[model samples]
Target: MILVQYMTKSSITELTSNNKKNKVVIHLSSSTKLGHYRASCLILFAFSCVSSDCFGELMEDLTVLSPKAIAMANAVTADPPGIDSIHFNPAGLMQFEGDTLELKLATFDLKNRYSTGPQQVDPTVKASYENLTQSPYPQDPYANQQGATSEPVLLIPGGSTETVPFPIVPLGGAATRNAQHQMVFASAVYSPMMVGFSRPDDDLGRYQGNETAISRITYFSPSFGFQVGDSLALGLGINFSYQGLALRMENRAPQASAAILGGLLSGVSGQQIGPGPYDDVATLNIAAEDYLSVGFNLGLLWSPLPWFTLGLAYRSAAKSNLEGDFSMRYSHSMQELSTELRPIFPKMEGVEFERGEVKMEFTTPQHMSLGTSIMVTTKFKLNVDVQKSFYSEWDKFTFDFDQPLDYLVFASLLDSDGQDESLTLQRNYKNALSWSIAAGYQWDKSLLLRAGYQRRNSNIPGNALDLIIPISDADFYGVGFAYSTSEDSHIDLGLGYLVSRYNIDYGQSNNANSDAPLDLIYNPYAYLPIRASTRAFLLSVSYRKPF
Candidate 1:
């Protein structure tokens, strides 16, 4: 009813009439067809839900801990320290004394949690009903028990059992033993040992059981800084980062659902399936890229009463365009299952696409931070900082796809709602916000300890309608130490951890035809409860020298 009402009121004819009568046309422009507009909207809507993917590959594995190393030790800044500051808080350069060069190497260890159950089972149910209506003995006890109905039925001979093994289906009559149900055969290889089924060659099958693995990401950062005035300094840092990812996934037994068994097909396969999810290997490569950006900082040294100083900084967002290669590959056994059935390979193109030298940019948000420190004694001092990111400026992203898929398949999956409906504009739906507070204390000049916390808002929407982006809100906690090696040299080290979580929600609409082959209109009416969490650990070490 809602779809019908919206279509009628906003129909092209209706829109044309409104345009002729009114001088100001509001909604969508008349120049573009509602279909294309809706398609673009759907694409953009999907992008907004996962804009985080737009950042360069390294960011997928990195997070900022404190704005600057000294500030990190003093717990005076919201963001993390290191060359990352050139991107997050350039104003941190203000504390530099004379001229200095710094170099750093860091690594990130990440733990991810993702899991999902069935989504939208209506189609399977409807297909079952259709099969029952075509049973051979429609009114027979067997047919009634299978169909749970006493209606007349029509039967048709299915595929050649040996030539194309159709699954032994309860629909249209008992499916021949050799019935070729490729979908079912594929499932058998996946969840080999679910309930009654057992896959003896589980290790060789594509759909192996549950699997887990870890990934290590590394970064190289170097910076040069010099003082301009009594209290101001400027610096430029070049950040180069790379990622090495290893993944293992367990496959579920393929889908051999039947109108007769209601998922009872497992009993017939008796294929010695393993006692768990199957296992498969995956490798993802992220190339190194250099980010060229600069930072500026200012400090005010004062002795109003001999014991206090104040600091202020405005960190501009590092304007950078990062370009790198992102590639992924996987090995599985599902393709082999087809050999036993049709002696042919099923062509699946989109599900396994990889990217190369994808150009992406990370435009850090403009930040404003204020800090104040007071000496309580000759050896003890405390510093505090508050900061905010103009995350709203983190706007839409542009991409140049090295490979484009078939238009029909892409359209069918992304823009199936027909026309006149969309959740977000394609290019402008992804923007986020961020903020943080920090404080640190110095017990003695030689032994300094630091700790800080931060929070970020998610740019993803609740509609859960994205294709390539992934967004999540995150929180961070950190601790660090600094040691004075000599008069002109110092070493600083920090450890930090961050937690991220978000949901992926979507829904299917009725009122669209059920019998039509392409009636599955995924409207994303609501955000489903999709919760994925990641625990990340950071280790950073840096050496600073005065020149």
Candidate 2:
């Protein structure tokens, strides 16, 4: 006799048949099956939602271009700055005495670590699955009722830590022709906002994103500055900007579970079956062609006394309409699943493999700064600066696709309305503020020393936190020096370190797809607790030559 049992939320039943002497007993738990099935479905939901968009922290114009400024933690706003003043404080260009060229190179080494609490599960759901029973029937009628309950599970076998390195280069030249008026002309090229990160393919956070590389904001500025009087100067520049981006992410698809189920059923029926019907991996890659945009910068410098100076600078946001190619590919396992299931489930074939045009609009955000430099002694000076970034302007991102994806499988399992040709992710970033202070001592006519510190606040909220850009409030410390090789040439070297950490504790109950079927999937275990720590070192060098 063979007994087959199917348990539902309402009742449990067993079917007995008299066919052969040998007996086979199979038990199925409704809750356990549903949990595993929902887990697989969540993968599909996440993949479809992020396939067409690029994900990362918004770019801030916080790059340090001048080795001297960086050594001073960027408090050079009111100092007699160099050609890098094109970004720090254009009015400082007016102080240059002759034709001067400056070139700078910097390296960034960053280390990041992520940790999470145990996986949380719903407390109400009593049992998931119980040990298999070999007997035809349980000795006690209630024996079958004993089942395992859901509990916290660690997605990542172990917390992960990674370190990455990046290089930065900036070039600029400034010339002052009229000694009396101190009229200056300057031009420079530099990266204002650049970010890149990559994670292992098997990272548990792969669903959010695996790799993000963006050069999306580079600046080419040409400017003019003039001394208005012995006490003040003014400067202005037109910024020609360029933007580019590339993003990649991976997700588990519904076919993975479907294939496993098919394999299990085939085994029961005494039929030969392959490993599985679905592939467990799906990847999305998007690259945008470089685009051009424009913005402007204005600055003012005031000297009330020979030993003190005040400076103000403002840079407008860069805006652009970007177009690019969107491509997606599934693992071979997925193709195998499609072939194996086509006869039974034709609709599952040829899904999620497509290529088309993608478009989106983006903005870089504006920056403003105010600073002062005070000569404290014959050979010593103190510099301080406060800056503001209008990150609030970046509230959300929208991506439009030429063709919509067939998210039918997701719709059915997650009980969704269907798929759309466009998707939007909420950023809801807040404005950020930063301040720096530094002191420089002129040891002699040929040597100088500098030291400084800075503090910056994070702009992202917990709900928007992800692996691609795990940003947090940070503190920076720096030290540097300058050596003059001749009357017209000098070299500058600077080193800096930054440290930050943040914790996120929130419920995913209000996420984009957290309704209806999806709601059931998250229910009692939507809360996630995660912690991230970051450390970075910056090394920079610059050379200046005046003809």
Candidate 3:
């Protein structure tokens, strides 16, 4: 049998017995005499908040990947397209009458700033039993006397700023043969969506999330386009994708408080040790191995008149089952406490609390796009595109652990019934629509100039505002120029700017005071109000050649 025990101050023992076949056990000890149970509970509460909160956004497909497409805010659906049509509108591939090759490169300079209001002390410290009595001499003298107290609120002093640079390269090729009766075949390797960021350990939002690294989500698409007459064409493609991710964050435990506890443990073990200044923080790191998934895309191109063209495309959602390992590491202080307590707690000694396997289910949202192009004259053209992202499918994110993390003091206090724990974060995301419009002028056949504007709506609700991605509705403005280098070769260059901002205020209710510890932690940022904003600049270049 597996036995777990909780010793209360009244010399009462609460015993929880389980089958020995179970691999994990949890124990909680509270000394009522010294009023240490309250301290332990507070510590556990912080742990509960840290263990449950995880955040990220699905914003990859929203980014325009082609130089010319981005130059016009991705309004290329109805325009005569090149290799990039594999992603924007494969049916446009029919415009290519011969073998074609294209290479595109893009860079993003992104900046984010976040600020929070001043921190506030926990309200419990201000509570006093003396309020119940008016007597000059109270039963507890120290009850109402408050000179100095513990500051549980962790603050970054000021705010924080993060700057990151990202680079992307996309390659594509297409071929047409007369023997196939006006059919075009194309293949491309590109990233439809990719997002990542990292911050320092001392960042103000460290408790929320410090780093998110998604190396790549590469798509290998092979497509076919058929010309059914001169006015309309159809295309279909299969998209194979590979994805990888690594997420890391610091837990909310104050190292100073943990070190003090460790010193007390050392004294109980008949050792002369004091709390160390360096031993007070903990971090949890999770990394997912690369995984593969598949999806499909379809496109249609129709020109009803000599001066007007319409295009439609749909990209299916891809679901990925990410498997990885999670590891928890403590400061020197926690390691010492675990060492001393292991002897009295034999069950804890058998379990490896440092590492465990984790599984996460993620889905890339689907997209539907419609576009139209009008030729005002031979030298001037106008284009408009509308897109809808089905983000309602991403309602929540859950991470499942293969083994229990009993080493966390709060895990034992909050939920001790199971050896495997599942952590779920509610997203409640909603579907969003985005649109773009652009105009292009052909300055002779050798030069073309384009400009456009776009707006993307936020999928995250105000109640679910997150610190990791800090997503918000954004506006994009762009300009570009395409130059013909030779009879069969051309180069396109584009520049764009994106801007967004959000206000965040999660209330101040402490979880330690909750009726049920398992309930979600609320008002985690009650002490501080947040203002988050993002600014990014995009530069892109593409080279296309006919062979």
Candidate 4:
């Protein structure tokens, strides 16, 4: 009824009331058609969802953890920061002597939006539905709408998963010279991704997902940097990380197959008897975490002359098996429909209240970068970096359920590539190449001015883009500065902004189709062209002190 009200834009008055059964019928104006279009493809997310495949790769660390890194657009490969060198280029640690400690704090403010584009439906698909249904409306059922979400959430596996204030991540590391070995040892803590967002239960965008957050925290990173030669250095780091994911989405299937079947049957039965394409059948909430995950990084730095230097680094790939719990709450209408269809599809056992343990297979691919830094003059320096992430390493993701979910079994029957206990979804992601350029100038003996820009490429192909993690090619612009408090101690502050926007044509994304003969997932806006965007503002502060 709410969907009807939103689409029809009519004031609904009481048509009839049955006090005995506590029932009320909505009266629609004569001009309003009872057409409620819902070609929605509701997806489950963790990178995928509880009962479907949807999420793709998430945002990387970028330069958020480093004030100078962000200020310099992550072009610091050739001129790594003090102790933060453990991440950018371990070899840079050799530049530090004696004891050094660094602390960093960063906050992120993000915005996401989705809006419907001009309607353009397939002639055959539209014609097929109109011909089969007895009470047919020629107009498109799914109308144009705009959606927004502001509430962000954080999930603690096996713990309280609550809504929190915007995230303020703290990252730091310490290192001391090992003169005897001519090597430097250090460790740090960081996260690859930790952001979440939510929408009101009745928000227009609830069909895609209600709340979602994916976290990859590196709790421990042990690193070593060795001075191999007078002008060369080598480094390696081993990282122990934790991965967690949380998602809550309202499920709906507005596929042609389901809608066609319902349309044909409704005509025969003289009424709408089962779930339609746009009906919100259920809500699924998933929380999973992996306590210990491992990966490694390597770095090389060379400086034959004080005027120029080159640096290279690689962060190894890793796999995680996040385990947790999931619950699916079915609507009363869906429950009754399942009961009526039980004779045929017995697995539709009315999953009004379903809970179980679940696990998923996820992979984080390796990353490689090459950078150079040059001192253009006594007071000016420039840094440039080229980076790549092997997202192509991702192909398929498997979701394992502790029990054979009856709902999954039924949902799988709609698609051939699905399984009862373990559901595998195809994910053909491509590698992304990005580059950055940054420059710094000494304003005076006590201050250094910095500015940088980076071009970030999208890993997901246009055909696979969806709202779960709708990251796209983006532009990152930043500015910051460093102030010398003492001869060897400095403070760094940076402010950065990034934006990624995409316009997905109708029927372009795989996540858009469920009725398509070959599809693995479903979304609510399948039939509508979608405009999605992400904008983020970052502020970072760092203090480096010699002990």
Q: Which candidate leads in TM-score?
A: 4
Worst 10-residue lDDT window for candidate 4 reads 33-42
Best by lDDT: 4
Report the lDDT tens digits of candidate 1 across residue range 442-483. Answer: 556665666656655554444432212223677766777766
lDDT computed for candidate 2: 0.56
The TM-scores of all predictions, comma-separated, are 0.48, 0.72, 0.73, 0.86
Tens digit of lDDT per residue, candidate 2, span 1-547?
2233445542223322233533434344342232233233333333323322222223243354467866887777787457777777788888677878787777665555665554333321222111121112112111112111111111110112122433444555555556765688888776665545565665545444566555533456778888886799998887776666665666442111233233333433223232221124456666664457787878999998989889999988777666777556656654554455444333445454756776677776788999999999989989999988787886776666676543333233223333445544455678878899999999999999999998866666555554445567778788999999998898998887777787655343232112122232211113234566666666778888886
Positional deviation of 31 in candidate 1, in angstroms?
29
The runs of at least 3 residues in candidate 3 whose Cα sits more than 4 Å from the true structure, single-residue gaps closed, are: 1-59, 62-64, 120-179, 254-281, 332-353, 407-421, 506-526
Ordered by lDDT, highest first, the candidates read 4, 3, 2, 1
TM-score, structure 4 vs. true: 0.86
What is the lDDT for 307 in model 3?
A: 95
TM-score of 3: 0.73
Residues 460-532, model 3: lDDT tens digits: 6665564555567888788999999998888998888777887765342232112122233322243345677
Model 4, stretches more than 4 Å misplaced?
1-58, 137-142, 156-159, 263-269, 411-417, 513-520
In candidate 4 the C-alpha lDDT for residue 283 amounts to: 76
- Write model 4 residue lDDT over 36-65, tens digit each, in one string: 121122135323452222222445755236
Clashes of each: 43, 7, 3, 13
